[model samples]
Target: MKILVVDDDPNILELVSIQLNQAGYTVQKATNGFQAMELLEEELPDLAIVDVMMPGMDGYTLTRKIRAYADIPVLLLTAKGELEDKEKGFLAGSDDYVVKPFEPKELLYRINAILRRYDKAVDVFIQAGPLKINRQSYEVSVGKKVLLLPLKEFELLSVLASKVNTVFTRDMLIERIWGYDYEGDEQTLNVHIKRVRGKLENLTGEVTIATVRGVGYKLEVASI
Candidate 1:
């Protein structure tokens, strides 16, 4: 997942960035709301962490602006712990709020909760012929046989199965699975695809991953 952290205090920003990065999320930092807006124009983050107090555009204004454009979740970070402050944060469009003296583990838990809620709001289960994929549980099964797959392999299969026969380019797969900041090359994606194909082969011709020469790959299901 990708997260954008906006704060005028460099120390807090760095601290949050480090913690999030260590937790396996792609983190982007902005010193203030203006910089956050600029970054938003370039790319939309999966979630945003905005401090309630800033120089030019305050966190509330920033949250409102963000809601106007995207449906991504926003988490407000500030020292205000009063009921009215939290109410205002929610009114301004924040999905969650955390006080400055908040525990790091609590902040992480809130982030995960927001993400889980969003994922559940959308359909988490995908079905393609005899193949079934459960995104929330990270489970893949063909008929009665449960397939064990590595994390990357499971994600790759999920993406392809989500859209049946729709061809997904290598770039699309990498961007969706590895994020925009993925440092790996096409060869890396190829390796994961190969591994997924190996596992799918155990399904006895029920599913197949078809490569489209110079294009990309698509999930093909044999007619029962």
Candidate 2:
């Protein structure tokens, strides 16, 4: 998972970044909210840990801006521990909160808990003919065998499989899989989707990835 830490204090930023990175997450840092916005142009992290106190464009404002178009989780890392402050943070749209002077362990726990809530049961195998997909593990299976998938390919398939038959435009796929802040090209996502289809060749479905003329693609649903 990727995490973005936004804090003006160099010490806190470095500490959080190092801790999360040690915890097995790719950590990105920004000294201010503006820098955070700039980083969004590259890619939106799985979650954001923002400090409430900053020089300009505080955590609250950044939280709101990110929430406007993305569902990526947000956690406030602030020194203020008052109930009202917490409420304001929630109002600004954060999935969770962590007080400053906190143990990195606590932050890790919260992050894990939040991720668990979003994690779907991949044990629920989805199948249409010879093809099968494990939703929980994000694994694609053919017959009794499961296929290994790269991260982006798996994510792309996850998005399509989760919404079978929904004709999602390339732009929509870009946003859903990459998030509103993704700086990547839609064509790259298209390529990944096509690659995923290449793996589903054994399935009897015709163009499981259905193209909608000038629109985009949809994962064709099986009939009852």
Off by over 4 Å in 1: 123-201, 204-224
Clashing pairs in 2: 121-136, 122-135, 122-136
Compose the digit string of candidate 2's lDDT tens values, residues 74-172. Answer: 999989999999999999999889987898777877776665445442225555444567766767766566787887787667656654666656755
| TM values, all candidates | 0.62, 0.58
In angstroms, give how far residue 23 of model 1 lies from its true place. 0.3
TM-score of 1: 0.62
Cα lDDT tens digits for candidate 1, 1-224: 58999999998998899888766568889998889989999999889999999989999999999888898999999898999999999999999999988877677777767865675566589898899988878888877888878888887888788667777667557766776566878999999998888888876578899998887899999986
Measured by lDDT, the strongest candidate is 1
